[model samples]
Target chain A: MTFLNRFAGLRLYAVLFVIFIYGPVLLLPLFSLDTGLYPTFPLKGLTLQHYAEMAANTSMIEALKNSLTVAVIVSALSTTVSIPAALALSRYRLPGAAAVLGFMSLPLLIPSIVIAVALLIILLKFLGVALSLWTVGAGHVLICIPFCMSVLMSRLEGFDPSLEEASRDLGCTGWQTFWRLTLPLAMPGVISSLLMGFVVSFDEFVIAFFLSGTQTTLPIFLFSQLRFPDKLPGVLALGSLILAGSAVLVVLAELLRRRGAKSANPGDI
Target chain B: MAGYGLLSPALLIMVAMLALPIAALVLLSFWRQSGYTLDTTLTGANYARIFGLSDSPTVWMGIPFYLAYPVPVILLIKSLMMSLTATVTVIPLAYPMAYFIAFRVRSGKSIWILLLTIPFWTSYLLRVFAWKIMLGYTGAINSGLMALGIIHHPLDALLYNSGAVTVVLAHSWVSFAVLPIYVSLEKIDRSLLEAASDLGDTRWQRFRRITLPLSMPGVIAAALMVFIPTVGDYVTPTLIGGSGGSMVGNLIQDLFMKRNNAPMGAAVAIVMMAVIALIALLFVWLTGYHKMRARRR
Candidate 1:
């Protein structure tokens, strides 16, 4: 009944929970290093051949380039557009803001597969738009916006609005007030929004899978590669690297957000 | 008006990409497809086939049944069943972690949350694919067992079934379940617990009365998060859930990609959305969650 033993059980459960989440993920690097192709547990001599093989693969490299290109553009585009809307939602007394937010967040509720199919129908059947990297990039932007908006919205809402009001009162034009006061204040959110958008667009698979015609994003490529058993090792090597990359990006974003939160309002964090 | 102006760019993008595309999907569903050329005729035949119009026995034995085109209905039920199982599993597992963070963790609260969710932001494809490596015939589990001299043959039964799909799904949504429940648990007033204890409420009693009810919103939110996504998930099932494990997602993919039936795929997609929304609403109603939210607002 005491505090110590009561939480001791919970602590143990927490440890097990971490293993459950990370266990499968960690298997990637472990197997990627294994000389054997299968991800079986028995220790095989370590090898870097898969990574080498991955480096040599032209299609894999192309997919990586395509994914990176899409992610960068998507991050910038989603964040840039989200700044105004996010600010509007957080700061303004706009009518139907809830409905706007609801509509944006609808993609989160509906299955990504369903969304992909919907977009596919639009591009191919209605618009007569040939499926290409352009369509994939468009899909990425759609999925990234809701996520980026939420990140920026939280950051915008987190700080004092009095500063913006004061700037406006001091005869600063609306645009000047936003540029001079609001944008800098919401810098952390903007950065976080960009990072969020990047991470989402980078790891995105379903939408790209449906929208892409001749070109393949890395995830779509990885998914197609999943069919071949021999392709698994290179897949593992690539998967491990991606997992590490995204993990780093996410941690960096978190650290920046925390630091930014502190700077935004002294002692608030 | 300025606010509207500020919002216009993001709003326009969503409308052009998300809203218009979905509207187009609905419109496409009403049209017929034949050999790469879409027939522009507006017809309800797709819906009819989906609802058993083409089939002679629309009402088999008492309830509406699809004698023909049974795959969508069957897979829809199965997908819902698996998602429900995964959602139910997620709550118990996620609640403890959320609770530990809410009540037990003294410092580094954000770090703990960050640690748990980092995996979520990573490649969902890789994460789902990991299960194939873990549970496949020559995957980690069977091979590990063999190395330990626990079993001789690799268990083919471990991979590619509803069982595999359910487990992967439950694992896949771990972060989504935890964060919301943690927020709800964190928001519980410390004073309420103390007041309940002063009134002779035991720890368990206090939790049952106050903590549980208050946290129901988060729990319900977690359930909806897990249930809704898993129902429409295509990756996990496709990777690990072979023929026996194929859900509505796979069928929709098949219809669109392989079967050359885009209109039918649209129909199935619409139907899936309708069913998912209906079930989610029903659950929220049953839990009185909407009333709770309105009252809170």
Candidate 2:
């Protein structure tokens, strides 16, 4: 009780910090609702004209499709590849475990622009691969795997080995034990990883910018459209929808993370 | 062996997708560039161009002078300074918020964290654009000021400068700072603070001696999380940054696309990575990260 009063000033700062963080973004939805062509102040009137225009834009719909496809493939690939690696890192006292972990996390430390440029060069020169959604997915997987591994490692690390032993004693084979026990235990972690990975791939711009071929991601399309003043309202409308969708996804992911934290061991994500 | 087998596919992907490409980037940095094709011959010309150093030695009275730096080198240094400024600005703001959530909220901590992260979940491009809209001459800030009769003319200095880049980047990366700091604050043993208070230490003294030292790891992590990524940020500078606010990343993109110089771009990328790694190492050393890791072990 005394502690709360001692630092009562902090609550004000926290509120201000929240305002500072979200003020610009929250204004986005307000402007989207304004009938004004520009997202400036003194809105003309409330209307859904921008949203209607956004709905009618073929390029916007196509970009959405491309983004979804890239995001789904990247999420699946990242989680699938990370599961075994996370298992090995958590369960075994492997040689060079620290080095392996460090290497896996290198992408997070380096600039995304560098990663994008490096991947672009590698695909173009060494592999003779063309710039496509597949290439973007490849880069996304490279970056997203580390995130997936971090979440899965926490879930896997806390598993009771004795549970597997008990299952085996009950005549369960390796595959059956994994299916019945291990998967269910780690399901929350897996879900969070998938959702977070999807979000990362969906919103990522740099790699998609470089690796995008004829079909571009939503970010790339939005970026190109930013230069045109006339496109501002419609883009804001699209951005508002995306903002709402992302908020839901992030909330779901956080809820899953909390559930995993309660049921499994508490891990600082 | 089975563990090794389990790790192989991941290792393969990392090597193939990440390590090998970086290696190729370094190699390409050295390779000579001709009209439109890169020569197989290895040369140090790209490095020389990136650093504004000349190979020819013309020592006048034992004093050495180099050629003028290319534009990208200047932008790289500017980017480093701007990113540092933004990281420094965000630390003070984020620390208080993280402290509040960790110690004050008590319950519904996750909800606070979720609210903080809501901005990040949305498109980073749009968030930066949002700042652009707010800062533009005819945008929110100017109009609000005019409507309130605070100022007659629109403020021209509100956007398209290094300062605007710093402000937007700091805001965009605040969640990164808050999360790490919150985690570290949570890890601190509450009884330690109580014990400090019980020893007749004032609140400031207890925070300085106990809480601050304990949270150094998170502070350093937060700093790195914000600093490293913002240094090479292309979007913020591109939209709100105008000519004066362009970064190393914007230059690198131009080097590849507009100038048709992949070798130079690769060299710039390599230099940027090396500079970031050096800064990170310095930060880790100053924060006693090695000692912290040892103590944990």
Q: For model 2, what TM-score is found for chain B?
A: 0.93
Off by over 4 Å in 1: A262-269, B53-66
Q: Write the per-residue lDDT of candidate 1 for residues B1-297, one digit (tens) a residue.
A: 989898999999999988898888888899999887889799998988876644465552266664577668878988999999999999999998999999999988988889887987898999999889999888999999999999999898989899999999999997679999999999888999999999999989998999999999999999999999899999999998999898999999999999999999999999999999999999999999998788766
Could you tell me which 10 consecutive residues in candidate 2 chain A have the lowest summed lDDT?
A260-269
TM-score of chain B of 1: 0.95
Q: Tell me model 2's lDDT, rounded to 2 decimals.
A: 0.87
Question: lDDT (CA) for every model shown?
Answer: 0.89, 0.87
Q: Which ten residues in a row have the lowest lDDT in candidate 2 chain B?
A: B57-66
Q: DockQ of each model against the real complex?
A: 0.87, 0.72
Best by TM-score: 1
Q: Go through the candidates in order and give the clash count of each.
A: 0, 0
Question: B1-297, model 2: which lDDT tens digit per residue?
Answer: 778888888889999999999999999999877888888799988888666666664343355445455466567778998999999998988898998999889788878988887776678888998999999999999998887889999999999998999999998998779999999999999999999999999989999999999988888889999999999998899988998788899988998889888998999899998888898899899878889867855
Cα deviation of A256 in candidate 2 (Å)? 1.6
Error of 2 at A67 (Å): 1.1
